[model samples]
Target: AQTVTQSQPEMSVQEAETVTLSCTYDTSESDYYLFWYKQPPSRQMILVIRQEAYKQQNATENRFSVNFQKAAKSFSLKISDSQLGDAAMYFCACRSGSARQLTFGSGTQLTVLP
Candidate 1:
């Protein structure tokens, strides 16, 4: 079974500071996709960024970027210029092309301090 792992239970960052959340996964298949999702108090899962296994380049979206290590099955998220609005629960998700179902990590709670 493929699974995502989030080592950090909680993380804090000052306003305008940058922070990176660690994540890892266990998968035997070579074809897969990694995703980072942000769940605010509303519980809406918003996609932060995503990386394709076949792609060597890491994915970046505005202030968010990912360090995707395919061999290690590690996909870490980096948030630059963090703001108070960035406070939320971040989750790591993976899906293989075969199953086409998402396997999500427990999650990492982020608190952006003022």
Candidate 2:
């Protein structure tokens, strides 16, 4: 079984600043994928980034990057130069090789204060 947990239910960051959203997971599977998804007001789950368990390096896409600590089972998302468009519901998810579905966290709503 795999589970994801996001301790913070909500987070706020100033515009053009940086914010890091924390996430922790427990998975029995050795092969799995960690992901961060952003859902805006339109309710579209956009893939911010993904990190494979076998990969030593973390995954990054533009200003969205992940700090993947496999040993600690921690995967946190860092948003650099936050923008108003970045304000959304962020979800941390895990997908094991055997499962077709992804296990998601409760989610954290990010607010960008101008």
Candidate 3:
């Protein structure tokens, strides 16, 4: 069974500063995808960034980026110039090519301190 682990239960970042949320996973399959999903107070799950295992290049989207260490099976999210709007419960997820379901890690709550 594949599992995602988020060691941090909560994280805070000053407005305009940067923060990184750590995530590690255990998977037997080599072909898989990692994702960072943000669930704000509204409870809607939004895709922040995604990284494919085969790609050596880390995935980035605007203020969001991932540090993907494939060998260690670690994938972390880095938010640059953090904003209050970025406050949310972030979940790290993984999906193998053969599975339709995503295995999610315990969420890390990100608070943007003003």
Model 1 lDDT tens row, 1-114: 898999999999999999999999998888898999999988788999989999999999999999998777789999999999999999999998798799999999999999
Q: Stretches of candidate 3 above 4 Å error?
A: none
Question: Please, what is the TM-score per model?
Answer: 0.97, 0.98, 0.98
**lDDT agreement of model 3 with the native:** 0.96
Off by over 4 Å in 1: none
Summarize candidate 3's per-residue lDDT along 1-114 as a digit string, tens digits. Answer: 899999999999999999999999999998999999999997799999999999999999999999999989999999999999999999999999789999999999999999
- Model 2 clashing-pair count: 0
Better model by TM-score, 1 or 3?
3
Ranking by lDDT: 3, 2, 1
Best prediction by TM-score: 3
What shift in Å separates residue 17 of candidate 1 from its native position after superposition? 0.4
When 1 and 2 are scored with TM-score, the better candidate is 2
Report the lDDT tens digits of candidate 2 across residue range 1-114.
Answer: 888999999999999999999999999999999999999988789999999999999898999999999999999999999999999999999999889999999999999999
Q: Give per-residue lDDT, candidate 3, residue 76.
A: 97
Q: Total clashing residue pairs per candidate?
A: 0, 0, 0
